[model samples]
Target: MLEPGLYEQTISRELKDELESEKDELVSELRKIDDAEAPKILAEYVAEVAESALARISESGKDSLENQIQLTNKMIGALDSPSDLVGDSHQLLYLVPKVMHQIRGKSERDTLRPETPMSQSSLFTGSRHEPSMGSELKKEIASADRIDMLVSFIKWPGLRIILPELREFSERGGKLRVITTSYIGATDVKAIDELSELPNAEVKVSYDTRGTRLHAKAYVFYRKTGFTTAYVGSSNLSNPAITSGLEWNVKVAQRELPDTMAKIRATFESYWESNDFEPYDKSQHDRFVEAVKRERGDKTPSDLVYFF
Candidate 1:
């Protein structure tokens, strides 16, 4: 819908021909999706495509999009003929999605979020989550608008400290996505099962990350204060790791480290959409837990049960 040819032709006052070409492709897709599920599928497609499109735009492009939308709203306010705004100025993007969902025989809330390109100084002092041993991580979690964590394993006791805060965040419409491992005696299955039960949270498990190039720990928090914060280091999703463990993780601010954040987000998405990880399963989790325990029982203390 935003092909460069449209703008070029508009400048030449020959927009009709180029616009028809673009519409042809879109119309073909629309006709093929003319089923009972069309609305839902279209809504979902728009959300996913918009996310990718907006994120790929440069900082100046994002500013232009926001400015255009805002300017349109300001002009809209002066219109005395029709002042019945369906959605607020900030949520104008959701109106069409909402209508499509209603036509699809479903109701889906939560519009596609438009992210502001961020860049800020790195938040690491000699490879640590905070400057010292402060509660920077906890504060980050508490202050986030959304939380995305990927760890090798999750320990319930360690998760307990932040569980309350996470629950609160979820209740307030924040999302939590956790990707952890379920390798032989490496990650606890019970931990994975526990995390899958939280509100507004989903968990993905890599049953065996042995030779799959997995071992990376990162926590991405999209804050309401206009900054995207992510931590990349050696910490897992265990209590000791989150609380007092001496792990080395570096914090990257999107504004200062936009490329780093982009790469990190891209990497996480690759794993997330791959066969290496899947939705947390209970029966399979039980079996995996048993196998992990049996494996650990048969191993010596010095033996490495799990390795990245």
Candidate 2:
């Protein structure tokens, strides 16, 4: 018999196929309506389809076969439409072909039925996206227009990619506010300086000896219509962590920007108030070390040093 997991996938696919068929009918009906109402109808239909499709995918991800097929088909179908026509189409487009290659040449009845679908193992198999919640988070981030990145530890690799983008935005006179911790790198400061060359760009850094870990990672992007925000769980910013060793991060986005923006701004303000701010100075490293030693009442104990 097919493994229980693969059997579930088969059922998921079938369910998805049903959903797609329904969505197709809705679209067809909308086209025959008054042209004046076409935009509204199309928007409603696309939103409905995305919501329904995403819900089905999430619900059946680990439990059904027909849903899986439907998901695959819908993803492939989205690739045929305009990029912005469908929400988060990038992940769907990539997922379709990759999942298809996995089951090519395999008989659905033999691979997913109550008995036949389980007996065969000769066909291809693989998962297109990395197995994590990252895919979901990535989609949310890509949907936003403006993002505020919070930085504490100057993770070089994360900065390498993210910093330049910020610099460019600042250079081009886009509104951006940066609040960074004292434990930053020279390279990072240099990058910030480059960004400062732009007018109206505000960058602030705090050197704190009394504060606890500002140990949160997140980005909030704002737009005229909405905002997207994400919080990551792992050290995705550093080289050793992101490249060589294990790391994890999550991104969450919502249509409501005001609330997310306010929350992030409040949190950053807490850090800013707790720490002392000074002009960017390369010579302050030793002063920071001294402050830390003072906070520790001598050289910080080995156990505490690990945290530092």
Candidate 3:
């Protein structure tokens, strides 16, 4: 009287439930192990599972002789170094599966995967193999929903290169926030003026030239896709720094280094909320210029006095 395929469906559900119970039991057992012993135990378990799988394959007699020989040779090569075997086994059993899951979908793969095959993190040293920081920054800006930049100073030459990208980003309704300082009169008023004029931009300047020593430089690109990126290092918004200088910047991916990215976002928010950097206003342009001139030891007309 039961409907066709209903019996098969019930069996499938039962099997799934049984497998889930077994998986939960295995996880519970794994959680009881001490951190120091976990690696060795996991490695041993992998070796045992691999040995059993190989034994089953050998007994099955289904694979071609050449294929079997090739697989055996690979296994022998993998076992040559016991220490390396343990490490490789861990990667194959744990890391590989997790990475595979993360990049299974096309969109997820493109967003979460590192641009370079070397690693999930990147070091931009202005080398031939590495992509230029300028290009990377533009790419981030183009795709970002919001951009945050904290630099010691901004130079017109560097800002000019990426200005078009920033303009397009703003036009597309992307929010931009910048934090810079008049620490050494290195920042150009022109750059600040142009940035503030952007449709969706906010600029903050630290006029406490003598006391405020904010020298950190970072650019954070926040994406709604959950794959945010942040560049942190010695590179300021300068032509040489982004284009050809030997500046060292570490590009961190939120998907790969969640803790580090979280810290970065938190720190930037703290700095943004702090009163040390005041919101830049067009009316205060003269004041900002004077501050920069004073820091640079350039005497303005106001500093000069006419004798009677």
TM-score of each: 0.54, 0.42, 0.62
TM-score of 3: 0.62
Candidate 2 segments whose C-alpha is farther than 4 A from its true place: 1-128, 131-146, 183-199, 241-245, 256-262, 269-308
lDDT for residue 12 in candidate 3, whole number 0-100: 35
Please provide, for model 3 over 2-45, each residue's C-alpha lDDT reduced to its tens digit, 9 standing for 90 to 100: 22232212123555566466763443211255688767666656
The predicted structure with the larger TM-score, 1 or 2, is 1
Clashes per model (N, Cα, C within 3 A): 8, 35, 0
| Residue 178, candidate 3: alpha-carbon lDDT | 96
TM-score, candidate number 2: 0.42
The window of 10 residues in a row where model 3 has the poorest summed lDDT is 85-94
Name the best candidate (by TM-score). 3
Cα error, candidate 1, residue 211 (Å): 3.6
Q: What 10-residue stretch in candidate 2 is worst by lDDT? A: 115-124
lDDT per model vs. reference: 0.63, 0.44, 0.76
Clashes of 1: 8
Error of 3 at 2 (Å): 64
